[model samples]
Target chain A: MDWKRYLFIALIIIALFSVVIFVGKTQTPPLVIAMSMLATTLMVATPLTLGALSGVFCETSAVINIGIEGMMLAAAFFGWLAAIYMNTIFGYEPMPSLITGVVVAVLTGGIFGLLLAVLSITFKVDQIIGGTVVNMLAIGITGFLNRQLFFEKNSVFGGQVPHAPGTLPIIHLPVPKVVGGVCSLFTADGCPTFANALGKVFDQRPIAILAIVLVFVSHYVIFHTRWGLRTRAVGEHPRAADTVGINVTRVRYINVVIGGLLAGLGGAYFTLESVPSFEPLMTNGRGFIALAAMIFGNWTPIGSWAAALVFGAAQAMQINLQFFRDLIPPAWSFLQQSYIVGLTPYLLTMLILTGIVGKTVPPAADGQPYEK
Target chain B: MSENKRSFQDALSESPLVVPILAIFTSMVLGGIIIAWAGGNPVAAYIGLYQGAFGSLNALSETAVWATPYILAGLAVAFAFKGGLFNIGAEGQLALGAVAAAWVGYALPDLLGAELPRYLHLTLALGAGTLAGLIWGAIPGWLKAHTGGHEVINTIMMNYIALNMTSFLLNGVMKDPSPTNVIARTPLIAETARLGTLFAKYRVHWGFIMALVAAAIVWWLLERTTFGFEIRTVGANPDAAQYAGINVKRIITWTMAISGLLAGLAGAVEVTGLNYRHELGFSVGYGFDAIAIALLGKTHPLGVVLAALLFAAMRNGGTRMQFMTQIPVDIISVIQALILLFVAADAIIRYIYRLKASEDKLVLTRGWGG
Candidate 1:
């Protein structure tokens, strides 16, 4: 179907929101709520987009990377730790320390990616189980370290991570803000109506903006570039690519390593950009959901980011369903429940997976171990 | 069925047990090193772990209790793997089973306005749980069989739905009614639905025996029966099996349903035999852990039993290891992950042991669009 048909996310969003509306109605203006939700979903979509982009890079090179979750998680903890350590030691500069943290997170993810590449590609382990091992390591190490550093406050964990949030910066998107301010001028909320929401949508953290830009960059790289052609060739038919003098193993390894960098950037979103502190399991299964996004997007960068936006909207709706419960008729309001609200993204994932809206095939050699 | 099958004498020297045992031993040694690095005396920690798993009647009982779930869950994964499928949805199936069993146990009698007989009530509860799992598992199987959907992705998505749905039921309609109860759990089952403990002093119950019998049944089905032969054949090669006139699609669906039935039984046992109620957080990761157990056991029924027991011991011992050394119990997961890593990527093991590679390899799953 040329795969671009997978971009039919409009129906998915409407279906999901209809269910939400069916459960209950909200007192807030639905349009305003939706606009705000659109803004927030993009914010939430950033990390997932990056994670899916990472998956695209790896999977498109014929390597299955279920370890994106673990990579992001490891990056999340270490990134937060690096930033905290720097802020405490290097004169309270958020930029330098936070940058260091982001770099460390990316490095950690890359290392984990390298581990996956070696285990699955070099050693020919089952890719899924190899990824499982990385996940276990991420969880165990992060949990163990979290206890020592934050819980027990042990000196051995790491000396003195900064508790300060002000040192962190929030980068504003000047373009979105100006446009939003003009749009909001007529709204009853007195201030520019769309200004705050538009700013919220556009004024993303550096990591968030990077995630959005990378979506386009990844798309261009995968579809338009010579390197991308070779990558797709390797993923779909390793022997064919190899016959053409492309280094299959090397491409898989290097692409997967870069995939890790993207996932690490996603992880940094959790600690540095989203929240200023580290918590156990803060990634909260988003990595897995990102995999779903990648699949839903038919393994394309723009499609994946779009899918991420859908998931992000679901997440946004989840947070507000309770407040919007009043929108429901009183009898049905009883049905407006947490689990059902929480169920939006998962249900949507499964529905999209059924390929009713769109169908796309994966790269032929996606999960197979290639041996010369 | 095939000329490549080994003779008794050949099997004796080249036992399938060797690689798995070595994997376990290597993992233990690695775990010991990690324990030492964590600042605990490795020998003492091992001693404590041993004591925790088998040092006393109480510890042994606890190990058996833990093994009850592991055995069934491992069997589910192993059974699926042998059928050329990866049953990642065991977690969801188990949850559905637990919740269904709990509903049947607690709500059925009240709905009927009479206390059902023990055998009937227990049977119904167990059957309901099994049925829920079968139905749940069958969806993905049917999807895979009919529409070329991958069970791996479908199963994971199922887990999310099952878990969230379960959470809702527990918190809302099914909540325990006790005044002090703030936990998300169901009311205790009717007395008739509960499984009796083997004896007064031990926590182990009839479920442990049931687990053993389940293992034996799985072994017999896979090794002795025609259906088992067909499943294995289809798993080995669907096209070849089809050419041989075997119904591959039906086998896949039935295989998944039965695998899910076994996993659901694990959840049923937990409710009727041990917990007596379904709690929101209980049995959270047992299904995922079963993947490691299945691989560790080499996907053989007997292997599954032994592997489940070993995993149970580690899990049970983890408590004591933590109490003594204050090392986080997550180390067990670490050891498990390491074991799976070595076993999954067996080249390192082969290189270390200088063993020849076998022509026949395990097929865990053929991921996405395969």
Candidate 2:
């Protein structure tokens, strides 16, 4: 009900209208476009929300983690590796592989968080530098591992790497007759296609749905619980918390560990949910985007989740905007220049940070180490 | 004579070289153990790494080839440290510089409608890169001084703009339209504009010498001059520097510009001296790695040179270790990470060794919000 939130949503609706008009004028099917946008939005939003949730834990503890990208990349690789090992060694299904990926990712995140906390808090090192170091290490290690394991000239996975340009697995589900009628209209344009309809019900790919659920659970823990209160206190004011008998360092360490676990899980989304195998730098800069979402959300868990959705939708919009390729012109087509179009989220971040025009304030201790 | 000898011995113990050497030895031993644990023959891998990095003249030349840009970029980060700003956008700045250098190197002769002399064309190309970096560096400094925007965020954001724009330009406009070329890169510079190779038998060139000279100049600038004093004063306390009549904003801007200029030089050297053309992925992560180099070097210009050489050797040798022993290049990353971990959290190193706490702590960044 906040004016700012309303304004943001209104801006999104206006942008959507302009896109729809551009598509309609260009002779694209409206129903198809609408359904594709819906599907893409949900798909992109899943990982982003998970990342934002992880970022909330760190930001609330006053640690601005710029290493989320690295964490995600490393986690993605290890998750896939763990999955492959489990399938080969223990004869597990894809479900077990996904679980293994999440578990390994959490452990990886915890280790990295420990290193970051030790450097920034224990040694009183600069948090940004420490975060950057972790990021570099992640990139180097991931790049090296990717070259060694994945880049080989082999028929690995027997060539079934999901998301690498192929038919998506579709499962049928029950829907109301009216919704089915609407879906029928959509299917005419390749939208409410049999696959799309099937994707919507029993449509629960466990990882993506689990990630969404984790977001709400993480938000609840950060906002409502005693642990959450102490965590927020340590981030906001270590001295004040110390005066009150909250063990600030211990809280920071615990939260950092938990934050890492979330980041690790978020990383696994790249490998377990999107693709069957890992790619070098697959998480790319989403981790940094998540941090930006956390900040843009004003250090609150739910707000950050919403912000991640906004960023994720921006990504989805870039793809859905392709329906207007004919209207947008060949040279400046959002499809051809999707990389440029992809910059919308970062540009949005800059605008938000430049202050609502001047008052961009982070949490009081967002990047400060607990001195005591 | 005994007292004099003791004092001389004390001076030697306090020498800058001791710290870096110790750091290197410790890292190497730790790397060896990691390699063993990772199921590799540490002895053979070490030999291969050493051989590939410095076993022969060609290896020595390649080592210098990698070290040239590392030294310049390391200086970029180190110089910024003196001004108390972390120049994280060196990667972007370096990319912009390389593109500018390549454009000038290749297009200027065509623009002028004449074949320019090697010296003139090379200087112009190199200068274009430096100027490009100066502009990139100045923006964040100006923003920090006037608008209170954090440089960390801005610099990181600028990196995206620079890299993406560079990609766009290379893929679209600047992309070499020659039928044989398909990758996103510019046309090669004319032979006249390239910095001549030093040995004629190796890829090593004048850039190595230039880097060393730049290091010397940086050392003199930080340790000897009035301008350096102003930079240090502002870095230590901008408020105090303002009280002392130093124009803090101007100094921050100049410091950033100089830092950018050095980073630009790193890019320019790679193009004109090493790579001969500006490709999208040519520079890789040298700018980011420079931060680690600067930290390991203790932010001294000499320290930067030494650290850069060590980093250069590891990178140069890593390929051989992987090729010969089948160990992943990531193992080297583990070693580098451990080094950074130990250096950044010196307490861990200190606790392991039971050493007394050191007096000088490396404080590179201002508090996060600022």
Give the number of the best model, judged by TM-score. Answer: 1
* Chain B TM-score, candidates in order: 0.94, 0.94
What CAPRI grade goes to candidate 2? acceptable
What digit string (tens of lDDT, one per residue) describes model 1 on residues B100-177? 999999999999999999999999999998998898888888777876667877787788889889988999899999
TM-score against truth, every candidate: 0.92, 0.88
Give a tens-digit lDDT track for model 1, residues A179-270. Answer: 75565676655355455555665656688778888998998999999999999999999998999899999999999999999999999889
Please, what's the RMSD in Å of model 1?
Answer: 4.1
The TM-score measured for candidate 1 stands at 0.92
lDDT of 1: 0.83
lDDT score at residue A306, model 2, on the 0-100 scale: 70
Chain A TM-score values for every predicted structure, listed in order: 0.89, 0.82
List model 2 lDDT by residue over A69-136, tens digit each: 77777787777777676666555245565567668877887788777777777777777777887887
DockQ (Cα-based) per candidate?
0.52, 0.47
Say which docking band candidate 1 falls in. Answer: medium
